[model samples]
Target: MDYFLQLVLNGLFVGAFYALVALGYTMVYGIIKLLNFAHGDIYMVGGFVGFTMLTAASGAMGAKGGLLLLIVVMVLAMLTTGTLGLIIERIAYRPLRGAPRLSILITAVGASFALEYGIALAYGPNPRAYPVGMGTGSFNVFGVRISTGQLVMVVIAVILMIALDTLVRRTRSGRAMRAISQDPRACLLMGVNVDSVIARTFFLGSALAGAAGVMAGAYYGKIDFLMGFIIGLKAFTAAVIGGIGNIRGAVLGAIVLGLLESFGTAWLGSQWRDVFAFGFLILFLTVRPTGLLGERVTERV
Candidate 1:
């Protein structure tokens, strides 16, 4: 029972990271129905940004100011990645909005490779060690050990998710997003600037992913340019599992996937974790194409 509880704890922390990345995937899909395959690269950008910021800050701030420095690094990384996302949408996606879906998808793939190699060219193809480390300070709850760093990370994820939920449910911009999602033409007729809303959506979604990247780097202590690729696929699976267009569903699916991976790793050894995750994806797609909260909408011929 203690071992099971420990696995659950591990799953929750990892799930929080997955949820953050998945939120970005779901938000972009919800607004524009385009799967931004490049979104994961944006996450890799965040990790590097945070790493650079922390490395620079270490000389001046030292270990005493670690937490404070981390907070600043996270914000800076978010802003940088958010701007990059806006640029990608404007230069790559916006031009092809009226083009075929396949065209935009190919463009996204190109963008992903561009970002990945661009980072590699700049930072080299090697993994960099995260300068900041969470000291070994932990307490046990019901014979299950938990670290302070993991606790802090999970709390931050929860706070960000809640804030995003509130923004989407209560803000005017969110209303515009939903309006555009339902009918872009109608929203334009109703005096909404569809382009601006879409741009903002990309910015916000990318910013969240950037934040997640920083958190993951802090937790895992190593980062690389290609780190986002597999995680991006997993996050997309979570989005699909929870209903691609549903924000809350994305979080739900991520947590579920995280837990499944945890238990799978425990039972079948760590080697089969990815296989287990994808297996569930296949099961979900085959059994329930619409997902848990996704509704079927018939297209007009």
Candidate 2:
């Protein structure tokens, strides 16, 4: 039982990362119906940005100021990645908005490649050791050992998710987003600047991905340019599992995927983790394409 409980705790921590990244996927899909494949690269960018900042500051800040420095680095990384997301949406996606879906999708793929290679060109094709970490201190509760770093990461993730939820449910911008998602033409007719709203959506979503990236780097202790690729797909799977356009569904789906991976890893081996995750994705697509919380919408032909 203790072993099972430990797995569950670990799963929740892993799920926090998925939840952050998946929110971006769902938000972009919700607003413009575009699957920004490059979104994951934005996450990679965040990690690199955080890495750069930490590397520069680590010597001066020392261990005493580690927490404060980390907070500042995360904010800067989020801002940088958010701006990058806005640029991608404006330059890559906006031009192809009226074009066929396949065209935009290809462009998204191109953008992803561009970001990945661009980072590699700048940072080299080598894995970077994170300059800072959340320390290796842990405590046990009910015989389930939990790391402080994981607890901190989960708390921050939950706060961000809650803030996003409030924004979506209560803010005017969020209302515009929902409105555009339902009927962009109608929202445009109703005097909403659909383009601006879409841009904001991309910004916010990418910002969340950025936060996840920084957190992951701090926790895992290493990062690389291509790191976002697999995680990006996993996050997309999480979005789909929860219903692509539903905010709460994305979080729920992330937790579900995380738990699945945790238990699967324990049962099988770590080497089979990706296979387990993708396999479950295939199963979900086959059984319920709309997702657990996704509703079937009948579109006009």
Candidate 3:
């Protein structure tokens, strides 16, 4: 039972990270029907930014300031990545909005490679160690132990997710996003600033990814330029599983995928985790194409 609890806890943390990144995937897909494969690279950028900030701060504030440094660095990284996301949208995606889907997809792939290799060239090909030590202590709940870092991370992630959910569901910009997603042409015709809304969506989604990246680095204690590649695919899988265009579904799918991977790895060893994840994706696609919450709808007429 303790082992089960441990796995569940781990799954929830992993799921939160997945959900954060998956929101970016789902948002872009929902609004533009374009899968921004380079989105994961933005997460990597955030991790690097946080790492740089923390390293710089450690010199001034010492190791005791880890918590404070984390908060400040995370916010900075989010802003940085959010701007990068906006720039990428303007330079890469916007131009291809009217182009063929294949062209835009190829461009996304190119952008992904560009980001990966660009970071590798700048930071070297090896993995960079996160500066701060995050494994400080643990707390017990009902005989189950949870690390301080994990607890903090989970709480931060939940807060961010809730905030984002509210923003999308309650805010004017969110209404604009939904409108654009449903019908960009109609939204434009209805006097909505479609481009501005899409840009904001990218900004918010990328900021969440950036925040997740920072937390991942803090928890995992290491990061690399190529770290976002596999995780990006996993996040995309989560988005698909939850219904690619649905915000809430993305969160649900990510948690489900994370739980599946967590238990599967425990049962079959870590090497088989990806295999299990992909297997589930295949099953979901074949069995229920619309996903858990996706509604079937025909093209707008």
Candidate 4:
């Protein structure tokens, strides 16, 4: 029972990361109908940006200011990545909006490569050790042990998710987002600034990914340029599983995927974790491609 509880707790923490990143995938897909393969690279950039900030400040603040420094660095990273997302969208994707889908997709892939290599060139190919971390203290609840770092990560993730949910459901900008998603041409005709709304969506999505990246670095204690690749694919799977264009579905899918990974790793060994994840993706695609919460939309011929 304790083991089961532990797995569940761990799954939730992992799910938080997936949820943050998956929201980006879902939002971009929802608004632009573009996959934004470069999104994960933005996540990688966030980690590196956090790493650089922490490294530069660690000596000045010492261990006494860890939490404050983390908060500051996270904000800075998010802003940096958010701006980067806007730039990518403006420079790479906007041009191809009227082009073939293949062209946009290829551009996305190219953008991903460009960001990955750009980071590698700047930071080197070696993995950098994170300068700061949430402490190792932990507590047990109902026989389940939870680390402080895990708890912090989960809490921050939940807060961000809730804030995003509110933003999407309660705000006028969110209404515009939904409008654009449903019909951009109509939105344009209705006097909506579709481009501005799309840019904001990318900014919000990328900022969340950035936050997740910082959290991952702080918890895992190491990061690399290529770290975002597999996780990007996993987040995409989560988005698909939850209904790609649905915000709530993205969160639900991430939790499901995380739980699956935790239990699968325990039962089948770590090496098989990716296989299990992707296998489930194939199963979902074959059996219910619209996903758990995705609505079926019939396009007009």
> What is the alpha-carbon RMSD of candidate 4 to the true structure?
1.0
The sequence of per-residue lDDT tens digits that candidate 4 reaches over residues 42-146 is 999999999998988887766534677898999899999999999999999998888998999999999999999999999999999999998889998998999
- Cα-based TM-score, every candidate: 0.97, 0.98, 0.97, 0.98
Q: After superposition, how far is residue 179 of candidate 1 from its true place, in Å?
A: 1.4
Q: Provide the lowest-lDDT 10-residue window in model 2.
A: 59-68
Worst 10 residues of 3 by lDDT: 59-68
Candidate 3 lands at a TM-score of 0.97
**Residue 145 local lDDT, model 4:** 92
Clashes of each: 0, 0, 0, 0
lDDT of 1 at 300: 75
Ranking of candidates on lDDT, top first = 2, 4, 1, 3
Q: Please write out the lDDT profile of model 1 over residues 57-168, one tens digit for every residue.
A: 8867665346667878898999999999999999999999889989998999999999999999999999999988654589999999999889888888999899999999
Model 3 agreement with the true structure over 1-301: per-residue lDDT tens digits:
9999888888887898899999999999999999899999989988988888888888777654567678888999999999989999999998888899999999999999998899899889899889875567999997788889988888888898899899999998988898898889999888998888999999998899999889888889899999999889999999989998999999999999999999999999999999999998899889886788898856656
- Would you list the C-alpha lDDT of every candidate in the order shown? 0.91, 0.92, 0.90, 0.92
Candidate 1 residue-wise lDDT at 60: 74
User: Any runs in candidate 4 off by more than 4 Å, and if so which?
Assistant: 62-64
Which scores better on lDDT, 1 or 3?
1
